[model samples]
Target: MATILYARVSTSEQTLSHQQTQAEAAGFTFDHVLADHGVSGVAVKMKDRPEGRRLFDMLRPGDTLVVRWVDRLGRNYEDVTDTIREFMRRGVTIRTIINGMVFDGQAKDPMSAAVRDALVGFMAAMAQAQAEATKEAQKAGIAAAKAKGGEEGGVYRGRKPSFTADQVAAVRDLLGKGLGVAEVSRSTGLSRQTIYRIKDDPAGASKALEVWA
Candidate 1:
């Protein structure tokens, strides 16, 4: 059985390489590493992501999957729990580094299965709650910053924009040239959702960029 490490990161903090380094530092070795980067846990379902889908197809019975935490596996309660149960059904073992949790295929009896499912459900709910809580906190922080304004007491620029004016311009230019959102994201290194947001509301995006600038 091969040990595969799956890593995922939303734009907030984690990165693929960074996760791998941390796992290694924690002394976990793996035969393969899969990553999904810049994918939002709240918005993107695990099954929909590229690497996530690949990991789903690649894993087989007797394979062991490792992750930094249950959150990396998924953030939606339903999806997370379903995915874990499916993996367990397929004889795949799921392990987490955070709590050193091990969920294996040993749960054959009904009672054992019920207990395992309950635990999975609880963790899945917690993961989704944490993701939502983080989003709410960020929104509140931005709102507070906007209300407080700058040090000079002028209009508050909520937060700095991740993309520069030139980058936004580049995206717009590519869009004007009729490039698809996926292609634009590939060429500009921006997330597909970000491309769609800019594409859908160019005026609003431009206005925000100007305010932040």
Candidate 2:
């Protein structure tokens, strides 16, 4: 009978507290809060994330799971739909704050059930499509930046990087999770400009470290 709030935070703007506040503003109260920080909803399945896995185990029949949106439940279309259906099957009510949508496996008629299922599929597909579009946009930006860098010069070794190898690795990992430059900079204690450089040409950043060493 408990209610839990789950959040997936990947950017500077989408803090866990921010999500909790959004849910509260929507008039949903939760007994517990769970979050996965710096985790990409597009790249990592919920079951694979540390807190996400805990969420699966913590929730029981009759418990309500609340999220800002359906996208918080999974990495993509199939994952989102399957996870929701599985939760519904478990008798755990799934609620989204955005549309105040509820999926409780309580449809009395086949038409209602079909409509619900269709909506779930549509939302999941949209979530995945949005993720893909963002990723592609990022890739295009990186390519353009890298090309510009190459045009500036090819063999000219720049100044030594301020980041250590570990810092570089952390930057890459955070970037891979789709974190913005400011968020990645804050996480790694690096400057925004350095993070942007890494984001633009990660290989070049690594090469700088190698050439300096």
Q: Highest lDDT among the candidates is held by which one?
A: 2
Q: Count the backbone clashes (under 3 Å) in each candidate.
A: 0, 0
Whole-model alpha-carbon lDDT for candidate 2: 0.84
TM-score of 1: 0.79
User: For residues 1-213, could you state the per-residue lDDT of candidate 1 as single tens digits?
Assistant: 889999886654456777788788878899999887667666788889888999999999999999998899879888888889899889999988888888877976999888878888899999999988988999999878777776558786654666777778889999999997669889988876567667767887788898976
Error of 1 at 100 (Å): 0.6
Off by over 4 Å in 1: 150-153, 169-205
Candidate 2 to native Cα RMSD, angstroms: 7.0
lDDT of 2 by residue, 1-213 (tens): 999999987655567778999999999887999887666787788899888899889888999999989887865888799889988999889999998988888888999999999999998998898888988998887777768779987534456688888999999998889887779878999766567667768898889999888
Candidate 2 C-alpha error for residue 85, in Å: 0.5
Error of 2 at 11 (Å): 2.9
lDDT of 1: 0.83
